[model samples]
Target: MRRAIILFVSLGLALGACDDTGATGTVDAVADVSADVSADVSADAVDTVASDAEVTGDTDAPSDTSAPADAAADSVAPVDTGPPPSCPEEAVTVYLYEDGNGASNSWYDQPLGSDDLPLSGEAVSITRPDGGVTAARDCGPGRYGFLDLPAGAYLLDVAVDGETTSHNLGRRLPRAVADGAVKLVAFGDSVPAYGPAPWFPEQLETLLAPFVTVTLSNVAIPGSQSSEWLPGGSNYVNRLAPHLADADVVVFSLGGNDLMNLASDFEVLGVEDALALLDDLDAAIVAIEANLLTIYGAVRAAAPDADVVWLVYPNYAMSDRWAQYLGDYQELAATLLASKLEGIRERMGDVAGLTLADMYGSLDKPALDAFLWDELHLNVAGHRYYAEEVFMTLGGVLVGPPTSRGVHRSIGFRP
Candidate 1:
């Protein structure tokens, strides 16, 4: 059971208060777009104009014939510096991936790309560290652009149907004590490294630099599950343990794709003279938990002192249609997750050198807008929140510099 704590990295944080920007007028003007104001606006002129009269009259001779001079656009709204200084750097690439349910689609982007792809009625401009502008392309459903970016801070705005529904920006910090460098190894479904934030791993590295230099590697494949940890049929843990072997922290966020009936969960009764089959359907969950246990153990063995944090599933409380088809799964899955947390706590209670950070309950509603890039994965804001939470829980004190040998030793080593 000592392996329990070693296998899981609980890198979640208590949600902090964030300004919820659900209202349209309140959204940040697209970052850096005002720089090339003429060009971007020209591309979007048709969408921006309500009707021909509005355009012709506004651009044409004085519309003395029209309603009172439009003062709305003329009125000056103060320029917002955007979220507090806590917001991090801009994301440069987006790996557009097909949903993990066995789809054949993938696209990638790095900032400056061809203009053939149209902007999502909602696509927005990406800002660079020096305040430059680049437009993100709407390749198609499940396809977006990899924005070319300058080396500075940035934020990713989630636009749906040509409007901003959510936005996430990253945070930057300086190195903590002991030259503390945090590296993120992404493990899970197609969402994290998938489109919109394809360069998410890179984004995390940029945002967490200066204070704590962060490195992230993506190991996400289609149809990944928690059970594939180490010795399972998929053997993901084996692939992951090596990359995380030298890190100060580990991030494990999965468990969304495994809701199937298993070999261990079937039972047939009436056994007197007739042979009966035996199975525990819930056994599948138990197996999954066990798999997580293995993952926790291997990571501990590899990273030893790194805090293995778990990025839990965000709220799907708003979907009514999915509620009917997947409601039970959602509820049961949530319950199982809650229990797993408790179980991990119980199993790892004796280990003095371990930590588990839960983000599900810690994330607040206001922060949720920034955290979720979609109903499932985290966007820029969400990733920033994650970095902050990870810093606070594991890397907070290390902000100064690296000094201790224990810092280098894997958490699995006996002190």
Candidate 2:
């Protein structure tokens, strides 16, 4: 994975209230009063025309053509039919990525194969052509945007740790298209919604912005398990169905909490006792697998055309500690968990447009200290790593300078 040097524009207000109605009128003075305007007028032009209408007294429909010639001719200045309006500022989208691929156990998880994790809470400043500099911190997983920025050449400075990296914006900035944005919806548990700032979905959004506009809606609830998202479950087919129906892509992480919660039941038992409880553990894994398949089926049905990505839980670095507490049955527990995930992956392989994100094999034990917040949840760094893996898995190309992270392998089955 490569670190990304991306840019973004922050449109100040929520665009929900924006009127899609366009401006109407013709360039010819003798045009019919009831004639509609050309549909080519942009949204900005419509706004300008509406504002101009309010400024003048033409609140009613077009003036009567039967009016006296002098009055009709004189009305031209007030009605001021002009060329299409041009926005004074441009919108820019920025994405930042860390350079290091995540992996575990495999010697292949060398430094050359890692992704640089996203630098969260980094300071970003933009210098305008007139020598004015505006500063803002990166928000939502290395994403920052400047909306309505004055049109001109600009400079971007991102402060990573104590060092500042700069990039020139040349003379032109990317403009937002009215209908070019991609809609994405993320479902599942706490790992994806790890915190308020650097969640993986948001980071993925920032990385994909350069290629297309993105409107992401995260419907993942904290503490949610796979069962809650199954066919008759609450969140999957009910709460998030509408979003899934309209999404271009859907990403989710699950099964960890289910396994962890199940493991707790046997924590007080000795190794022999825990061994005796294997039947219960096996049943739990079977139930989880069934629920996962049910959820996958619902997602496919609801979002027929949408691409779905499933993130497998990473290897629990604290399994040894957990085993110590559970009379040394850690290996058995870990094997069962891995088996469940493998079964799910094999099942997903048969589904068209569904991909598995093998985070389980992505990070090794040595990398756990920096990534895992606990035995289960990922810290901010871990979330950043997960996001990059996802972005790469989804075919998003890093657009900045490349590093020596070796040849990145795409995770999951891409059909």
The number of the candidate with the highest TM-score is: 2
- Per-residue CA lDDT of model 1 for 356-398, tens digit only, reads 3334334433334333433444444344445444443332211
> Candidate 2, residues 90-199: lDDT per residue as tens digits?
24334444433422111111122225444456565655434456674333555555555533333344444321111111111112111355677888888778543567
lDDT scores of the candidates, listed in order: 0.35, 0.44
Ten residues in sequence with the least summed lDDT for candidate 1: 9-18
Q: What's each prediction's TM-score?
A: 0.42, 0.51
Best by lDDT: 2
What are the per-model C-alpha RMSD values against the true structure?
22.8, 27.3
Off by over 4 Å in 1: 1-177, 180-183, 198-201, 231-238, 260-282, 315-354, 364-374, 395-415
